[model samples]
Target: MRSSISDRLSKMDKRLLNVRFKKSTASIFVLFIIFIIVFFFHPFNELTTVNLQSYPNLVDSLKGNTVISDIKIKKCFYYSSCQLNKVEQLQWRRLDSPLELYAAKPFRSLSRSMDIFNTFVFVKQASAQTVDSALVDVKITLKGEPINDSNEGWVSTDYDSYTIWKKFISKSHETFEQVDLVRDLDILFGMDDLQDSREYWQYQRTSIPVNAPVLPHLTLLKVPLTSHNKIFTEFHEFQSLKQNEVLLAKSNSLKIVQISDLHIGPDTGFCLDSSIDCTADLKSLEFLESSFEGESSSKPIDLVVITGDLIDSHRTKEFKSSILKSLSPILSKKIPFIFTFGEMDEVPLYEDKPEDENSPDESDLKVDTILKLNILNFISSLPYCYNKFVRYNQNLHGLTNYNMKVFKMPVNEETQLKLDEPAAIITVLDSENHKIDSSQINFLYRENQPLKSKDPFKLLFFHYPLPNYRPQGEFKLIGAYNDKKPLKKKTDMKFRDDIASLGYQVVSVGHEYKNDLCLLSEKIDRNTVINSMWLCYSSGAGASVGTSVDYDRKLRVFQIDFEKKQMLSWKRSALKGAFDHQMIHEY
Candidate 1:
């Protein structure tokens, strides 16, 4: 009876085990079904089902479908007799959209007829049909224009055309109408009733009459409205010395280009002393570009120095644009550059007003200070400009007074570990007031106190010639001396002696437009030549400024060999080209 009972219990246990195995198998099958559903049928798995071959087309469809095929500017004389003349047709790059608009030719009012004119901007746009449908009634509006239900499909850009137009008009006395439409097309009436200022009209009577009608200097921009597009307002493509201080120390030799007296104005510049009718600003830019192109491959330019007179302060209403235009070549090449202030640079905007208004009031003073600060901020903000990094001493008489050091390049990784010393030092002083005061002298003495032991090659740069700077003296002269009245203020001999005592080898300046001489003078002490310094001058590069018509616009090039401790300079003429009047100095 015990054996029979045990057999029945065993049979029950087997049945229970079989039932548990079947239940576990059914649960596993349910989980597999869920996995299959998630892997192939779930909404999140749709990405995997898309064909890889169509990915590029899918991306293209998502991008901006509108394309700006062409942009043109048309000038007209009257509203009734609208004879459109295509003044400019910009060839824009497919990758780079334009950020600013500039006039290649100045818009002048008809002097003889005295008829005011208007300008029209035409933009040819093309659009691709989207997957949903065609872009229906696509419209575009300039920046700062009002957007409402009437212009529901209008696309807006990042630029503010209205503000830019106002800024441009502030520089001139010509009255302008608000930006309006000429027709119900892709045409914009940029400037309306554009008349010349009374000052310009009087000047035109004395000078040769310009036959063109008055047109506005409006800012034009062609940019994509897509969210992914980047707006390039500054020189972001170029590398700056401030970001890469090692750029100067990496090479044993350096080539520096010195351009001066740009005299850039708000409008396309007028010919000052030129015989032929030409655009001065455009010509000046061409000269600058030629100078850069004249540089040899073996001796490429690394630094540029503009010794003041960057803008025509008399017409400084559009100084920001003028400054940008003047520095285009340097900015384009991404070369490091420095500049000093000329007397014109310091002229207050209110100084041109009437006698009572000429004396700056409190508000005028504030405005002047703000303008100066804005200019300084703008210049310093440029990627390749070094003017902002200049150290200022309150005790000094002028702004932009500082010193820079160029260190010797390391031979290898091991040599770079050693204590680095400056191979050369450059000191820039402000002689804008036409004299170097005792405070600047004291500042120079104090700054050089620590560097006395190292005895590096010291070079000084300023705007005006020194008090003792004689064109023809016991010194050697290398270039032209056409300035009948050399701009030199009276200062004590102590300043000259201090420069020699401080071990300054080269003292360069730029003020006289026709003077391009490099005078080498020796400091004699008791019949012994104690020290020698090169007093050099850079000629005016702007055609708008007063210069000898016979003398072509030129740039001064200085090549410094750190290893040899020598500097070689020469002139690069606009008409005659480069390699003229070469001069050298060994320290």
Candidate 2:
């Protein structure tokens, strides 16, 4: 009986031990699972720094009451001369970091800091899970103002704050990439300090550590402007008709936005709002807006080429002002644009003012010539227009004729622009009288001389389109001017051939006011290799005969791959109509 009782007691004790063992195993499994969740979801690993400890005290301080400390903000203006220090030490404390403290250089400065704007903070990730494994959450405040969407004091929390805040995401183990914050800042306030409260300009960035229990908690690190250096760097200013070159991006693509025939004047729809049917100015403005909007969404407009006829027949000062005002909304974006003259821009020679007391006979006193020169000067003053060529090429009948070379810019600070092979040659030719004179052709040939051996991608811009030789669209050869005075041979049909022989892959023209893209296939070296020369016409933008007929205004955007010596794609963006757009042609 004693033995039986002992056995039963032993069995009960063993059962209790088994229950405890099972519970312990379950607890260990739960802890392991929790640790794994923290390891994968929460990335609280120490960041490695050069000339500094692998583990920073900021991580420990994150556990305490203090949010963050030991951060310095460096400020510098990015004018033509500012140099950005790209050292490894300057790469820390990104806005997305749990305890971020850094200053951003200004983007572009217009005359010192008048129109200066620097993206202050680009916090991609605001949360700890978004930051590091140990970090739970982080809050950003610019100038003692919280950036949360609930705050209506400093930021516009109504519509875009949430979206902008959500765009901040963890880019890598060390940094968070902020995409839309800069744009949000631009929208909320004006681009620079002057737009927002000027008083807050001094206070740049502040970070608040929200969670982490070990070190000082809620420690705030205010990164002030420690230093601002005004350093000058070498930059090439826009020179005269002698080749103003631009760098071709790594993609080997060149995008040209053609806005043609904006016949803005007092008579157009802008000044005639009372007449709803005569809303040409309004319609023209809408078309420009559409074209620009499309460009902003798609690839950036590398070069905006205005193919003549910017003004109407009524060349009054008021009309010119009205025209400038009408175009201000688009050109104000500061896009790089070049100009060519059209037939309508001409004021008949009879309308010229009396000659000056000592005006030379060689000096052109024709109203048309004077008007063209005055208009050229006016556009040259504009921020976007690049007509420096007029300053030097005063001998040409049409001062607009010149050439610009596009050079490939280096990939980084260490690399320099490649001057050996020009990426592309833009030949701005003069065809104001629907004719290309031998002198003009010779000028073009001279421009093409230096680039002859390089075999660079060539693009020709003028105001007239090649004559449609096909039977279906048989049209008079209008690309050249014919002398009304009796001459043995009148036709300038060889103009197209001359351009083709010079190896121009594309010819862009306006005047026609029609959106047309066609290939001029010609045999090269009389071999099997056929060169398909692209001829494109940008649709009329303003009130003109073409705009009146059919009323489908558009901007033609050409995307060319210079490396391949072929146009990758071409599309016409309609200003108005049921169809958004149709692909005109593609390579």
Candidate 3:
């Protein structure tokens, strides 16, 4: 009448129900182990996000701002941080040990701009390669915003921002995309010797942008997202400070004195009279230096600009050494050296005396001359025939008769007489403009005879004159060649017109020792450009000044006053004596 003993036993076990629970638990344990393996060794997983659509909509406010307080980062989704306003219990993220953070109130700017409290922490995380929990041993600062600075040059901020973005990716194989926000800046905050390429503010422009109305206090937390969005930002308390601004200054009516061609040598009175046996040459320099020092006027010397030709010649090493020593007196002053190359400062391409075949011996040339000769020979080899002919001229013998009489005068003279005319120079273009004619130097500003007075101070310096001069003074003693035949081709029409067109008030020249300033004028149709100063001064310190030249000539010194727009000139005895007589001329 009964089924079996085994069947009854099975039925009894099922009724207990505890036996059924054991089998179900064992199956779940197996599945849990499989899940643990997938989580630890998987390459990358679908992003995990806690969807919370109930948060306050602050997207509109965050359109421009980098950090929006309305969205608080929680477990996974952004929460309604707006409702948590006021001193309400706040969630502050701790960065490290030395730093602290807090969120308090809203900040307001004078421009009526409003922004939530934004805080930053100045932490010395020496190894900021990767973010970690323990390295969070830093602090979030309450104040201390980074000041803006100019960038020296450009650099690559690509790798630097890549460091902060690396922690977000889930898989090791995934590479982070370059963020343009950080790519533009150069991350040169610490290292030196970067030269032009450098960035002053470290992470300010990128991650921790100062967008909102600067809050006072803030906290820096390392709480990261699930290896997808590695965001590192600040949690801050809002406090206000009366913001300040900066101002700048200006300078007006800046005046300066430009003095050039001040060939101050030891021999001020080297070339004077053959009969009088007196000294006077370069007499202007002594008075010029003292005049600048004596000027007790307002704005005496804001700046002393010197174009060039300040020295006679530092040709010999010994001569150069002496000059450097003497120059200390002037250079030690506060005057700035605004200088450029002059025809004399640098050595001449051609020799003062071309080598002569009449030399006592062929090897009489110095080692320097020999080296220069080699260079000349090599240059002659070029295909251009110009340099070959130049080389031929350079190698010519008795190149010039320096001892030849440049002038011839009567045996005796009483009144002031013409001593000697200037050397007949064949003008060559200066080093600046190579193509300038070498045969003609007619750029002198004095074409219109001679003049009496000039309104403004004008000066002209060059290597030649517009026309040949008749011999002057007594040259019988020195014995030199007189003026050569007039220029083969009539005076240059182009250069003559150019000089006459210049509206100069005064012009100072050094090449001629005519000791005169001719008031010149050119008839330009109905109008006339004339009466400008045509100053041809006398200075040949290292040479003789002929038979009848004066020992006490006009050592002219022109002074200018920009305030009143005036000019005062004087002449001295080259001995820094009272300008003896000052011609007070003003404009």
Candidate 4:
């Protein structure tokens, strides 16, 4: 019986072997036929029109016969008189981040995939009729390239493309200027040239420590100009930047509350009234009320200012109003309100079509495509916490006629602003604008003249600090590969010489959303006693990511001791269980 079973099994094995050989031959033939069909059809071979017309920023490249073949840069701090000749590399690789945006992100950012293997450029509007619209379409053609699975990747948040472009601008500032880059340019590339970040992002999202401090380095920064199209360091290296201490009071009799980075509704996950279904704005306000612990005091807030990014996007009027109205009820307590614009609140200067009411497709675009031609009204329409945010001291000793008497001035308007009482002024100035140097409001912060006029002390409010703050023409950073973003062409000389002409004392700003502080210690060219002051996101109310060494994240609170003539900034880490937020003792 065993012999018979073995014979049957051998026969079955032979039949199966024959069938397997025949199947293999058929499969090979089928594959050959499919290959031939694909070769003849060549359906995926069609060129993809880049619609260079869609993005006008490339206008600078229009005059380029010689494209940006490669770039090299060596940059340093603006104060380092390191002479242009010593930079060694004309490449802006060493230039610090020229273009940067500050706002917080959700603990969990949505991983959305974006195709970034495309070309982009800045261009000027074609005609006068385009002024009101803030955008114009250009007639330009672009070479096409094919995309493969490798070109697409999932992004958990807005990919900051402007950040990437800024790196390019920073790295090749010399090369582009030397090449006579026009207002627009074209980015032509081959199919294999497309780059991707899927692997990079995957590692970042899965790797942050749960108990980490929300330092600027760990947070993600998205460019406000281009569609948040680039990604930089996620595991940011943290550092503490120390500054000179200023004592506000001998015994401490003043209360200072810092409400920071209140980016009104648009472009971020924290933005409420948007599609993300978040109440971050409301929550921030609620948290603030809790922080303050009560309503209008017989003693008004020592000083108060929103500190830039009053509105998330330049054109989001209704959204901004919602934020203002919500706060109006609180300010009804008669507390002072002051704020400024971050990169998001200002009109974007990229060369592109000013998408408007007529252009429904672009009506929802975030950037102000038409740069110089843009309107301040769109920006002015939003509510700023104060007419100005400044760096100055307030005197509390006076005849008791009211809760608190706050005296200040605004750069945008001429009238002297008097709020019920101010805990402190976090001035938000438009550093990009050249006209602010002569600002009458700034004179108050520098000199104590306003304090002499019945008021106990005189203070000021404006965005971005002078002297200490680099205050250079806005540009966009450092990355693993190289310095990614660069400044716009010929945009550098716009600082210093212009500032030397405008004399002022102290200034405070909030575009940097880290919890701790990085105040500039440089004294004004004219004044030795007064140092230009800048405190980045002194209070980490927003989830904006920070940069390595220079910034980080934490919820900060500023305390005032007027008698001592100093302000103590206290920051508590929201990420770390530790309550030690950090101290910017008196910027």
Candidate 2, 270-379: lDDT as tens digits: 33334454656567766777767676665666677777777675533322244354455455564667777776664332233453533324244453455455566655
Comparing candidate 2 with candidate 3, which one achieves the higher lDDT? 2
Q: Root-mean-square deviation of each candidate, in angstroms?
A: 26.5, 29.8, 32.9, 24.6
lDDT (Cα, 0-100) at 204 in candidate 2: 26
TM-score computed on alpha carbons, candidate 4: 0.34
**Quick one: ranking by lDDT, best first?**
1, 2, 4, 3
Taking the tens digit of each residue's C-alpha lDDT, what string does model 4 give over 291-336? 4444124234544544444445542322323243235333444343
Model 1: weakest 10-residue lDDT segment is 199-208
**In candidate 1, which residue ranges exceed 4 Å CA deviation?**
1-250, 273-276, 348-366, 389-393, 410-420, 452-455, 471-473, 484-490, 548-551, 580-584
Candidate 3 C-alpha lDDT tens digits along 128-186: 12322112111121133322253222111122111121112212222222211111111
Candidate 1: pairs in clash? 109-214
Model 3 deviation from native, Cα RMSD in Å: 32.9
Error of 3 at 382 (Å): 37
Best by lDDT: 1
| Model 3 worst lDDT window (10 residues) | 238-247
